[model samples]
Target: MEDVNPRIAGHYDELAELWDDIVASPSRERLLWETFEGLLPDLEGKRVLDAGCGSGFYAARYVERGAEVTGIDLSADMLERAREQVPDAEFVQADLTQPLDFLDDDGIDVICCQHAFSHLEDLSVPLSEFARVLVDGGVLVVSTHNPVHDYVVVREGEYPTETMPGDMEATVETESATPVYDETERYDIVWNSGPDSNRATYYRRSIEGLFSPVLDAGFEIRDVVEPTPDEAFTRENPEIAAGFKQDAAKSVCLKAVR
Candidate 1:
């Protein structure tokens, strides 16, 4: 567990320079924001924790909503960028797989983990820690790739290559867990930023494997949302739009209450 965080952190640290460009038109994240927006309680004067808050993209939104936000990330480089992106919020360099010692019991009202949740090799301790820190009835919102759409393959002859292109399709299957992240279940992501590209790895867990820990941590599942891109975004990117319409949206959101 200790080594996993550093390995993942190092990868993101390397991509820090090109992170924004690669995710410039992040439609997938837009869908997650839409799903979480309605379910989130009033943020005004509330304490919000953006767990695994990379680059402060979502943390800035919380700050705009009047929440006193704290954003934490494993990568120092990512934390540096997050601080710059959301100067008003507090940024901390921390590992998710370890105890969040900086926070006290029942200290937070809401915890949000965006695309970063899937990076955790184990969820038990973190979920328990979330339960410990969140006030009763507090919300925990997370977005991850849906296991149904885990059918992903590297392009032919792409192996032993540094990066993969952007013109790839993600398929869906229910039969077995797809090793998008390789044998150990870590996904090799080639993030493209203009002419430059960067690589990062992420874990892929089955639907049941992903949510069972939350339930075990005493969070009542409140909402399970499969969001589609908004009309404007969809029109701008028709290929991605078609996948959502075909029920192949690779991402999903879960809202739970402690």
Candidate 2:
């Protein structure tokens, strides 16, 4: 928890210029978008909701495809940058852990959230809210770090100081549990400043990618795609590019229809 809401927003506001370049580097996100492209059935006049839409990169693609798009984020700074790049999208600011303020009941045709889940203390509430905002038979697409493919590589283990060119594999399995963040929350992590500070993220997910929520939310799993990148990702890691035939390095795609 941060007390500096204004500073938090300002940090992103100041950092907004390099936001896209920093996150989508080597174009892995194009693969993420290709996953969305595969999931969208048809969007000639559909209404789409992009939750946690940081900078509207995903929303702009939907808008271009003729879907009316609304995007929401917790950071007003990110929303500002999104507005500059994607003027046609409806962008707003809202806390994702709570019910949304800007949406109407059964008003959305599709729900798309990327790199945003598991940031909250719990998944059940937001999952329910996603169902509430969507019309019946609509869709929800969520892309996340594939806990299935590479959890042990990230925890209770080590990576080379640099990612070397090789087939990296480990047989170790890890399980992560997410409980509401009470004052008594516990972690065994050893915290430090340098690599840990800038690179640290706080939440964890259930093992490997599971589908309990889609069933609970009443959406059917349509497709789970690990889409290929547009030229940039392949150039960075030819091995990784081909391995999409098997798994993803940092993220996985989940497409469910309401």
Candidate 3:
């Protein structure tokens, strides 16, 4: 765990510029934001925690919706960009896998962790921290890479990759290596940022393995959403949209209440 955070942080630091472009794509994140935001309660005057908040993309939205947002990320470079981009929100360099000592018990109204769970080996640690920090009946919104989609990606060895082209062009590409997807284990994935690519480690877990920790941490599951591409995504990247509907969703979002 000690070495993993640094490597993950380094990967983000290197790709921070490219990531800014990728996260800004409306076609890529529209459905994800819809699903994530649809589950939240009123954000007006609420204290929101954007856990593993890379570059403050969602934190900006939370602030716009009248929430007091605090964003945390492991990458210093990402935090720097986040601070610059969202001046109203607080940015902190913190690790989700460790205890979040900066926060007090039952202090947060909502916690949103998006696309960050894949980097952690165990979900229990972070989920426990979330439960501890969230007041009773508080909301927890999380999104992660879909294990079902990962299973197909590993079995097929090829997938329709979404690139940062203005039109969001997707092409079927073959993977150099395919890792086992059935077991709960850590594996490396090559993330492409436009012309540049880098390898980062991620955990692949079964659906049961994914949600058991949330339940154990005393969160009552409210909704599990598999977000489909929006109309713009379908119009720009029809082939990729078709493949996603035919096989599995690329990501799954969950809303839980403490």
lDDT of 2: 0.63
Model 3 residue runs over 4 Å out of place are 163-182, 191-197, 230-233
Stretches > 4 Å off in candidate 2: 1-15, 156-200, 208-210, 227-236, 239-248
lDDT of 3 by residue, 48-137 (tens): 999989988789999999999999999998898899889999999989989999999999999999999988988999999999999999
Could you tell me which residue pairs clash in candidate 3?
A: none
**TM per prediction:** 0.81, 0.72, 0.88
> Candidate 1 lDDT (Cα, whole model)?
0.73
For candidate 2, write residues 143-201 as lDDT tens digits. 76555433434354432211211232222222244333222121222222123122223
Candidate lDDT (C-alpha), each: 0.73, 0.63, 0.81
Candidate order by lDDT, highest to lowest? Answer: 3, 1, 2
* Every model: Cα RMSD to truth: 5.2, 6.5, 3.5
Residue-level lDDT of model 1, residues 1-258, one tens digit each, is 335565577767876765665444445345656776766888998899999888887898899999999998988998999888888999988878889999999999999888777777778988999999999989998887775554343222122211123443222222234344332255555544322224455666667788888999999999888777788977777876775676556668889999
- What is the model-wide C-alpha lDDT for candidate 3? 0.81
What RMSD value applies to candidate 2? Answer: 6.5
Q: List the residue pairs that clash in candidate 2.
A: 137-258, 138-258, 148-208
